[model samples]
Target: MRHYFNDLPKTALTAGYWLFVAYLLLPLTLMMSMSFKDANFIAFPIQDWTLRWYAEVLQDRQFLDAIAYSAFIAFATTVCATVIGVWIALVVATEGIFGRAAIFALACLPAVVPGLINAISMRIFIRVIDLPTGTAAIILAHTVHAVPFVVIMALTRLRSMPKNLTDAARDLGADPFIAFVRVTIPYLMPALLGGMIFCVLTSIDDFVRTFFLGGYKPTLPMLIFAKVQGGMSPQINAMATIVLIATALIGLYAEYLTRRARK
Candidate 1:
């Protein structure tokens, strides 16, 4: 099977890989193009462009507040998610924790479940606990969404390590903390950074959970959603273009980092 997979021509291989890349990029490109239309109607025939949506969205204090709030929540939740995810990965990969499979299954619940379902369930749960329905709820919901991804990212790093390297560190009079600091941490660096960036992206880009959890203040995605629903605007196109650029840059950087790690 390995030989058969490896036997494909390099051009065929490259094309297949780019096929996936194109699939990921196409919608973003379309969204960006649509956002820049000079007219109110979002037609696709390549007309004049304007930055009014960007100006208007930026001018609104509510939208500005949403961006700030989303940044804060995403940063905090990313930290929390990374810590928990890496810890869980370490324990499961090295410590043989009880019912590891079951634990991982539970952790993955948020990812597998529908976003609306997760948001509804979370809203009810938070209400039961008497939690506020605004930024606090958004942060908590984002954390829940981010944890499983962080775990998966960290696990890739953990499994990629050669067992012998860690064992040798331990044998050299280094305890768990010391060995991890000196050896595992450095090797898993790319995965950790990538995971955190991915978590931030997921948190900021999420609309469904944020819509239910956020009150009054809207995140950038929610703001985009609201403007999009009412009617198309040139400035909205401009904002969407900015987001598409940001996403592409992050994904490209992440891909580069992963490739560098392999090399």
Candidate 2:
């Protein structure tokens, strides 16, 4: 009785942790299972498991186009976001340019604001600037949304880096740019890769912002939203399942980089 009482907090914490995990995982499990069912509509106790929906999704031309466009946007957003984020992180971490807190807050404004608000603001900006609204616009909007997260991740990684490495390189007569490229970039790679993964995923999954900001062209998530407006199909489930698997793989890679960086 004494032992049980002494361990009560631990028992409660363990229970709470499992409950939290279940809350997150249960829906995903159900969705994946539903994706496998050979049914026209979504339901639990899925039966007649088959891959027909996946085959259909692959065969669908519009789905393929959406996937291609989404991939392009995600790749572009990752590049822009990571590059800009690393630059911002470097300045904020090292330079005290325009004051660190102000710079960081400016960098993070997109992330701090609600997605809908950011989308609306970008939409207005695009209209005001007379920018051709299409893939470029969507990519720019997504890049804006993704940069802050990358900056935060990069800044955290930068904090852990040896402060003297750049100084040592400079002492060895390396120019500032050369020192940054050689001494700083290698240390930042893992975090940059991690941030890129997240940025890519965010760009791919963003529907609300893309839907508002993207003109004419629809992303994969936007296409899914359009399709679901009519009715839910196993094909959508199949697409979602494929995306889920890809996300899991990328997440694993990110975890690997994070662990390797720690070493």
Candidate 3:
């Protein structure tokens, strides 16, 4: 009796963990399952399971265009965000140009601010500047949202980097730029890679901000939203499932690299 009572917390925790996972994954499972169902409309007790929906999605020109556009934006955002973030991290970690807290706060402000607010602000700013909205506008907005993630990751990694490596490079008569490229960047690469992954994911998944900032071009998420409003189709489910699988693969690869780096 005493053992049972003592084990109650463990039992509860185990049950809670499974329950939480179910809460998170059940919907995804349903979506994936539905995607395979041979039906024109989304329905449970799925009948005639087939890969027809996947085939349909693959042949969709508009969907393909959206995917390509989103990928381009995500790639651009990752590059710009990674560079800007590394610069901010370097400044905060090495130079005392601005107080660390102040710099960090400003860098992370986009994360704290609501997405809608960021979207509205960017829209207004672009309008004020008479900048035509399109891929460029979307890229800039995504970069703004993504930079904070890179800054946080890069800063954490930079804080732990051995200052002696950089100093040693300088001591060996290496110029600052060369020293940074040779000594510092290698050390920062793992964190920078993680930040790149995060930034890509953020840009790919973003909808609210992209909707406002993207002028004529539609991203994957925007495409999904439009299709969903027209009513759920198996093709949409297939596209979503494909995206989910891609995201999971990327996340797993990032995790593997991070663990490998630690070793």
Candidate 4:
């Protein structure tokens, strides 16, 4: 016998969802409020609401520098990761590649493995290889981490792609490169764009891996972590709020563009 629809729980589900949403967003909401507080101590229910902290972040040299550094690294990671990931995906999609499964597993190991362990291992490996721990090193590390995500996204699109499209293009006198550029790329653009955005954000917000790999340069997240450890400040809260808002905006824009492309 089927249970009656009236027997189903409703309020419990709503309560649980609300609790989960609060868990995900309460800290962010608190941070947003703290950013506007006019005092050093981070008290809930801000006494004064001011944009002073936001202005301070704008004027602070260290904050500006960190933002620039993070931006550079994120952009670099997105580009390198996208290029390598797409190329690897193309190789994976092609027939008769030796040890294709092995290659896929190797490429995605960074994504599935514990990042802290990976960081330590990467640090050891880089030192052995005589690679300097600087921006270049961070870029390399970020790219390696970013590539797996890129591959997963690109491969999903590539596998479902029809072979007849490429064949038809070839029959119409288009070269392999042209066919891929004109057809495959346009079709794969959404997943590729989404992956690139994810890569950039990951590289930007990353502190643990960047902490171990970075020589001296403090990326924005690293600096924020340091400030957070010292004490709570309106400035830190303000900066965090700004970053969170920026990330949200980017995600929304990317989603809009990708959805539009699909339509």
Each model's RMSD to truth, in Å? 5.2, 1.9, 1.5, 2.6
CA shift of 120, model 4, Å = 1.0
- What is the descending lDDT order? 3, 4, 2, 1
lDDT of 1 at 160: 79
- The sequence of per-residue lDDT tens digits that candidate 3 reaches over residues 1-263 is 78767899888889899999999999999999999999787777876889998988999999999999999999999999998998888888866575887887898999889999999999999999988888888899989888889999988888888889988999999999999999888888888888999999999999999999887778999999999999888888899999999999999999889888878
Instruction: Check candidate 1 and list the clashing pairs.
Output: 35-237, 52-235, 53-235, 53-236, 54-235
**Can you write out model 1's per-residue Cα lDDT over 1-263, one digit (the tens) per residue?**
78657867976788899999999888777777776666777667967876666777678787677678878988998999988888888877866578888877888788888999999999999999999899889988998998999888888889979998878999998998999999998888888888888998999889999988888877899887888798766667677677767777988998898889778
Q: What is the lDDT of residue 19 in candidate 3?
A: 100
Ranking of all candidate structures by their TM-score, best first:
3, 4, 2, 1
The lDDT per prediction is: 0.84, 0.89, 0.90, 0.90
**Model 4 ranges with Cα > 4 A deviation:** 1-8
What candidate 3 gets wrong by more than 4 Å, as runs, is 1-5
Task: Compose the digit string of candidate 4's lDDT tens values, residues 1-263.
Answer: 24445655765677789999999999988889888888888876667778998999999999999999999999999999999999999888889999888888899988877879878888998999999888988888899899999999999999988999889888998899999999899889999999999998999988878988997879999999889898778899899899999999999999998899789
User: Lowest-scoring 10 consecutive residues by lDDT in candidate 4?
Assistant: 1-10
Error of 1 at 49 (Å): 4.4
Off by over 4 Å in 1: 1-31, 34-37, 44-61
> Per-prediction TM-score, please?
0.82, 0.92, 0.96, 0.95
Q: Which parts of model 2 are misplaced by more than 4 Å?
A: 1-6
